[model samples]
Target: MFLMMGLMYFVVDLAAILLLSACWQRTRIRGFAIVAASYGAGIVARWTAPLAYRWADSGDGGMGSLAGVVVQTAFFLVAVVAVVGFWDIYRVLKQRPAA
Candidate 1:
């Protein structure tokens, strides 16, 4: 259960990596960097989860604190940006002739 929950956190980053890989030429290093940052954000957020739960109740009140909120916000924002960029790149790659 614990391992499964932990894996769930990286779903976005993993998908972004795979998608960016598919459109490698279109995204290049920038896409990879974005995904890597997102992944890093997730790692930080998870690392801070203990403090978040301890302060923010570890109850039901969103299960987070200020630190948790900041880290989680960063993670979500970067992950979303990476995924969107990858999707757009993939679309462009599919439209053009394969290089």
Candidate 2:
């Protein structure tokens, strides 16, 4: 069961990486920097999510639980995607030639 879960996580992560890379080129961002920056920010957010849960839980039963970690990771991923995706679309439009 653990193996399957790990596999699923790997597959999903791979898909996300591909999606981000493919989408990066079309942006006026001009370099891989934005992708790297966004990914780094996401990682930091995920790492910090436990603190969020702890605060919400009033200092008890923090993200010490498996479910909490998963929730935090998912939230971080979504937030990163939203912020980065929006910037990417904006960049794409800016880079497009006048028509």
Candidate 3:
């Protein structure tokens, strides 16, 4: 079951990336890496979201509220964006015209 879930996540993530790429202009490899990382993080968070909710009320760690899930998701998105944006900028710089 766990393996199936992992495979599904990978497939869904890859499909999403491919769909996005169809409308966007970027290197396939870079897009794949960014999307894969982001999707993996999302999958992990979603898989653990329920646990987060359950533990949030445990009143022990810093994640002592349902808000933890939201925070985690936001953090994951930010990380993905940062990585993708940095790579895009690098690509742009690398393609700059010679002075």
Show where candidate 3 strays beyond 4 Å. 1-11, 17-28, 60-63, 66-70, 73-99
Q: Candidate 3's residue-wise lDDT over 1-99, tens digit each?
A: 977986787688668656555534554445445555565566666667666677676766666644675867676675777478458756866787757
Q: Give TM per candidate.
A: 0.46, 0.40, 0.45
What local distance difference test score does each model get? 0.63, 0.60, 0.64
Q: Give lDDT tens digits, candidate 1, residues 1-99.
A: 976877776675567556645555455645555555556656666756666657777567765556566666766786697696566656656777877
| Displacement of the residue 3 alpha carbon in candidate 2, Å | 2.7
For lDDT, candidate 2 versus 3, the one ahead is 3
User: Model 2: which residue pairs collide?
Assistant: none
Model 1, 29: alpha-carbon shift in Å?
Answer: 4.1
Best by TM-score: 1
Tens-place lDDT digits, model 2, residues 1-99: 956875675566556666666666654353334554555455556556656666657745553565576676776676666676567767777778989
